[model samples]
Target: MSRSSTGDRGQTEPLAALVAVSVMALGLALYGGYLSDVLPGNSDRHVEGATQDRVWNEIQTNGVFDESTDIETVLVAGSTGSNEATDLPEGYNVYVAVTRVGDDGRTEVVDSHYFASDSSPAGDTPSDGVPDAANNATRPVPVRESPGDVEGGRLVVSVWT
Candidate 1:
């Protein structure tokens, strides 16, 4: 006398589960695109190829810290699409630190670190705060080589996305 069958109920449960899983997968994909800078207005703050090549060239050609006024510390900054973006993320992969260049033109990483956001002490921003340390208690990066025949005395910094 029953119009509904137990087999139909079992099939319905599996179908419902499958639909829920599919929806969850789609939501995760959308979120990943949004976070990976693939979505519209997403800021792709990656290291420029020219910048990296230039720094490497300087190190290879001029030789690391060959002069007395060689670069001591470098502060790498990262942000979302040049300041024209909205709701910038609170943290990025940019780093800040001091490095010592040897006569062989090799850069030796010394103190590498990043700064957290001003809002959350436990959070990080898309910018590097090494420059602020120049005026603060942070000590001037040790000058291993003096400026003698060096063309540019700026530090060589490399950033990764």
Candidate 2:
């Protein structure tokens, strides 16, 4: 009887281990599938927010479109990559624009910088002056024309992947 009981215990130990391993593997497979389906959608939002943050930081740091500064000079340099302070993610395009609002609240573009990409259609400009398909994030920054001048406008940043 003692010999038989000892043999049964040994077999049960291996069986329990096998069942545990199988359950763990199934759980892992399900989790991986869930991530594959969800990650792509969340990634776009992440990129949008990140791009907005980068553009805002650059404008604040470089004083772009600020009063007493040459808008043309700053815009030219920024468009040519000389004034780019942030490193964007792969396959992303950024368009920065400065707009001024009139007394009637009508806004006009003052200066703009567009970084075009050859590979993605998202970087291409449409005939209607809008992106055909892309994710965009825009932020309006108040410009300072002069000391205590409320004649400021907005700085728009559009990021697309």
Model 2 agreement with the true structure over 62-147: per-residue lDDT tens digits: 45446444333443355545443334444666566667887678886755556543312232233345475656665566676665
**Which stretches of candidate 1 lie above 4 Å from their native place?**
1-12, 38-45, 48-50, 60-63, 68-161
All-Cα superposition RMSD per candidate: 13.1, 6.3
As for model 1, its CA RMSD to the true structure in angstroms is 13.1
Q: Per-prediction TM-score, please?
A: 0.31, 0.55
lDDT of 1: 0.38
**CA shift at 127, candidate 2, in angstroms?**
6.6
The C-alpha lDDT values of all candidates are 0.38, 0.57
Alpha-carbon deviation at 27 in model 1, angstroms: 1.1
With a 3 Å backbone cut-off (N, CA, C), the pairs that clash in candidate 2 are none
